[model samples]
Target: MLDAHLTTQLKAYLEKVTQPIEIVASLDGSAKSAELNELLEEIAALSERISLVRRDDNERRPSFAINRVGSDVGVRFAGIPMGHEFTSLVLALLQVGGHPSKTAADVIEQVKNIEGDYHFETYFSLSCQNCPDVVQALNLMSVLNPNIQHVAIDGALYQDEVDARQVMSVPTVYLNGEVFGQGRMSLEQVLAKLDTGAGAREAEKLKNKEAFDMLVVGGGPAGSAAAIYAARKGIRTGVAAERFGGQVLDTMAIENFISIGYTEGPKLATALEQHVKDYDVDVMNLQRAERLLPAAESGGLIEVQLANGATLKSKTVILSTGARWRQMGVPGEDQYRNKGVAYCPHCDGPLFKGKRVAVIGGGNSGVEAAIDLAGITSHVTLIEFDSKLRADEVLQRKLHSLPNVDIIVSAQSTEVLGDGQKVNGLVYEDRVNGEVRRVELEGIFVQIGLLPNTEWLKGTLELSPRGEIVIDERGRTSLPGVFAAGDATTVPYKQIVIAMGAGSTAALSAFDHLMRLPVAAKPELVAA
Candidate 1:
């Protein structure tokens, strides 16, 4: 049940409800049901226009549906919507109770205009920082279109269903009983998947837009910062990113963001996005840049081609397309991905509760993942390709103290073993003796490393051997009027604060480059 502070906040929020709402509970004689019932009772107590009803018709026990009294608009939760999902629950309650959503009007219209049946079920974990976005987006979709029905299910509570469905990732969505997606997705992303013409329409709209003074190629911390800084100079700034949050959406925790002592990846990404939006930045999310074409002559317009065939022109461009998690390229790893291969321990560890799992790394992330998994899983096998763990002494000590964790150094993952449906074990090689060993595990969490998202920039910009954008100290790339920053650049430290600073530096450098351009070349582009 919500505590006093949360109850007060919920009561205040519920005061905005303009229509009667119904909370129908599907419960059984179980401890979880009792807990859910108590939570529902407390929720109903906070609002005069809200009422609770007891029902057991749902196949998923301890579930509940929030419905508007006179409409088909409703959303369901199959477990206690707490932790990161608490915001999702609150938003669902308000949205179903006639409170308006802050989603863009065009997007809401697109959702309402959708014609087909979409029964979406999102499997989530409480500790997952990314699940709420997918859950909330689908919840809003269901609220907008009566044909769309969505239920957010907690994988930890619905273990049997997760196993049966072979779900090995958080926020894994199923639309009409088929896999829709398996990561953090915004409302626009969900709409793009549903409305077939959405991408074309978006591309057409983008094509007609005027050119930008500074265009950012990503929307992570670095790109957000660059967009904000560029827009603050009273110039036309736009950000075209595949996803607004970039790889940060997959990240879980952050303890070293300067002033902020503690924060989550999604939270920081959201804040960065909002801050960028506060300026005159045109944030074009879910846009993937496929190619970059520099200006034909000095001080001319630079063009960026998107995957959708729309070309974005700018006086200056900043490339901040961040990196993604490195995958174990061993055999069967790709075939069994999401069947058992995972990246984030905070997200998928719950799905393997009480099952033996393997952590394939010895770095800080791997050791930390093992330490985190040791608490939830029956046992954790930490496999390191290095001679010793590269984690901090504190983390290594904590990992060693765990009773259910085993550390194996100088071992290389060779293959992932599965029973055609789900992972059953793993095969590795001892680097010291060249002996092959197989460990039985239900899941494998790969914490190996990250690879720069510079594949698209190949043959377009000067890149390091490791695929990072080669940049000078001032954030200027090898190409004139083109800059780079963040994890995709040659920056030594790939931290949030460093990325932000580099972003600002890149923006400033781009502005300087613009000012120093031929005075005659600026008028035509600026006027258009």
Candidate 2:
């Protein structure tokens, strides 16, 4: 199944294996099974220490497991691990074969010490960008601890099972036959759920840390830039985030990042994180800031309290908390959420295969979603609140050419219709003639816009009427020694490049603010 170039790369990567490994296939007499066997044989042939064997024991056909010769490393794939999951398969091979993993030492120990048996099955779409993280993390855990076992299933190939479980989203994980989580999750997040004491331990660690010269309040592009610039100044810098990637994790296509002509959202987010780690930035993931306490007086430390009761202090703080997906507040929308309502086409589009669905919005996201869904779903009805579509002309032309797609401009989504189980239809109002209409469908995809993640800073910081943090050209907030940037701020045109530039400017401004503080107030005096 792999091409010559990919085969060469896979062979080179497999050389990291320091011990013998076995590939056990649990496949049926099917085309997919034959293809998987071919791929596995090709992989085994590339390395002398690797061997393949057929063992059709698992009920899931076309599946295979990577096991260390003398150990019970339980990492398996339920389909051809290609597409976005190719890296996951590669990592599983190396890790299972006794090759070292880059996971933190503490985290590795924690995984190895977990108490109970965990059999996790994750359903993922091949096109999903977020699935690989969850898959790779769980696979690594399964390899590290025999108590844990993981199977990454391709939802498109295993549609029957996916439907039986009512999995409407990608990366939907089921542990011991129960829903565990349903999105992009890091290793720490998974451990925090399984190991109840992990949060308390992390909170305690944060509370005991020395005050940072600059503390970034998010880990998106903006927050990463701020942390990097501050760390380069040879001062203590820290970053705390609810999730490292922020809204970018849900984003799929990113064509306008400058220099890099084309890239995916999760890929860019990963690159941003790795770049930040290359510096001295202290990155704390899965930390949600509950409140902010401004300095009591000039030259005092700013305190940021997290939801887990941990408090972090800093000389100067940069607020780049970023924004989140905006939802359509129409009636029944919340009731039908996840049952048939979704936000990402790349992640959830597979579940709606051959079914009728509706796309709500007329912007680029909505139009692009319609275009993508048309290829999977039976039909796509695009409803827009505005008089006309706001998408680019090229996209509009492509959307118009799709036979299964229909556009409804000047219509507003009013309600989501469901039978108390799943979405069966939708209600809309025709703006042109003041008429109400209902479309019979099984899904609704909302692609409206973004809301600033500045809700926590409502009363603490000066905010614009639209809820964005108010900042000057130098990225200073109303509070002294506090600065803001990114989509969360009042920066015109919320773009990634702009957010990064703003973050750098805010970090520089924060440094200047600290330098002007009283000599005793400085964490350590800079040469200036």
Candidate 3:
């Protein structure tokens, strides 16, 4: 009768409860028996207060993992999470609210010290799989904490962004808004900076301000030439480019460029870059211009907008955007590029010294490359899609006079043969035989004409059917105050000397346009 009455009263009390119940106690655990007795008393009280605690008896329940054995608290120590310690700690933390596993502890320690935002901008090309590690590290740091942000930029997709940042190498990470560290760095090194709070302080110190004057759009021969001239004229200049040396960087050797007749393309590019460094020019590497717009009325400034949202305002703008090698668009053409297949004989021909190499296409460029390669390599095979070489008679004569040079008429490259990584050789089909034959070679040069890089300017500027920018002799484009030079423009012959001359002409014309602008518009004309 007494128990039934008590149960009834308890049910009535439970029905009246509306708020969360709380229990607070500080038990002395120093004495073993006393601590156990206290814990038991607390547990008994908890069971009476909670129906769920009272319902469970022998089977493992919610508090089993946390329950102390005797009067001691169950604790574990970890030195290193080398083997299974890391996994064990992580699983324990996930399973119950105890000590974190060794691995989890280490991971926490690794990223816990990061107190401020870290912004990393890295460049990577499709060809570089090694950059994935860098991307993963930065991403891991970002995910582990809130104060870190990592951005992995594709070199090709964000060409303009890369150009604006002047990225020359892959895995170039910029912290906050300024360049932090470069190349492949270890996780420990990165952690050390975060742990010491140096990176956070450094990030806080960076200031956003305009630091450049005139930013030349390209870094081809013409662009470099223009930058050199502009810097020498006492103008603060910046050169933004996807690649510092431009397309010429891929060339192996140049025997035709005046003054320096015999030099590797990469070497020449390096020299040019060094020369620019000698001046006050701010060379921004690996940037691409996404848009060009007139700046707001700030004295006399013209702005070049990059894909990265960075803008360069200059008093004078010189566009020396160059052209790229025209691909055959054949089955294996792209697959073989820079492998057994090549675009510039001057760049890759030396690699085939004492070996066979094929020069594709029948135009003057093809004939010229074949003639040049024949002198350096042991054997040269000239494969032309057309029935005859379309070069000038003198070039044709020069090509035919070479004893080791074999001219294969009416032959077209059908397939480039090799693994996905590198080209081994190529398969060509003869118009007469309708049969295909493979030619083994150390390398192949695609000497077809280049395609102008003017697709972005399609509606904005006048372009020929071939897509070259149409400009006057003075390098002025159809649009007012716009000028173009180098291979992108409607220049007849594409050569270093010619591009340099055209760049000089364009720079002078741009200067003239800037001078004509009103004094109030000068700032707008010159902000970079």
Top model by lDDT, which number? 1
Q: For candidate 1, lDDT tens digit of each residue in 1-528?
A: 788899999999999999999999999999999999999999999899999999899999989999999899999999999999999999999999999999989889888999978899999999999899999999999998999999999999999998888899988999899999997888888888777798998899999999899999999989998998898899999999999888888888899989889988998888999999898788899899998988875237999999998999998999999899999899999988988999989998899999999999999999999999999999999999989899999999999999999899999899999999989999999999999999998999999888999898899889999999999998998888999999999999888899999999999999999898876645545655
lDDT of candidate 2 over 1-528, digit per residue (tens): 889999999999989999999999998889999999999999999999899999999999989999898878758999998888999999999999889998889899999999888999999888999899999999999988888999999998998997788888888999999999988898988999999999999889988999999999999989989999999999999999898877888888888999989988888888999999999999999999989999974337899999999999999999999998789898999888888999999889988999999999889889999999999999999999999999999999999999999899999888999998789999999999999999999999999888999889989989999999999999999998899989999998888999999999999999999888887654877797
Candidate 3 segments whose C-alpha is farther than 4 A from its true place: 1-213, 252-267, 294-301, 344-357, 363-380, 391-405, 418-443, 521-528
Winner by lDDT between candidate 3 and candidate 2? 2
Give the per-residue lDDT digits (tens) of candidate 3, residues 1-528.
114554454344434332222212222323432433343343234223321112223121111122122321221211111121222222321222222232336546667566776666655443332344455456555545656665555444444565566553455677877877654444545675556653343223221325444557888888888788778778677787766767666554478888876875656776887888788887765457777665444434666766555667676667777998898778887655545676655434444557788888878788888988888789988898888889889999998889999899898788887765556677889988899899987677888878887766777668999999888989888766667889998899998779989988887777677667666544446668
- The lowest-lDDT stretch of 10 consecutive residues in candidate 3 is 75-84
How many clashes would you count in candidate 1?
A: 0
C-alpha RMSD (angstroms) for model 1? 2.6
Best by TM-score: 1
Q: List the RMSD of every prediction in angstroms.
A: 2.6, 3.0, 23.6
Q: Where does candidate 1 stray beyond 4 Å?
A: 297-299, 521-528
Tell how far residue 370 is off in model 2, in angstroms.
Answer: 0.9
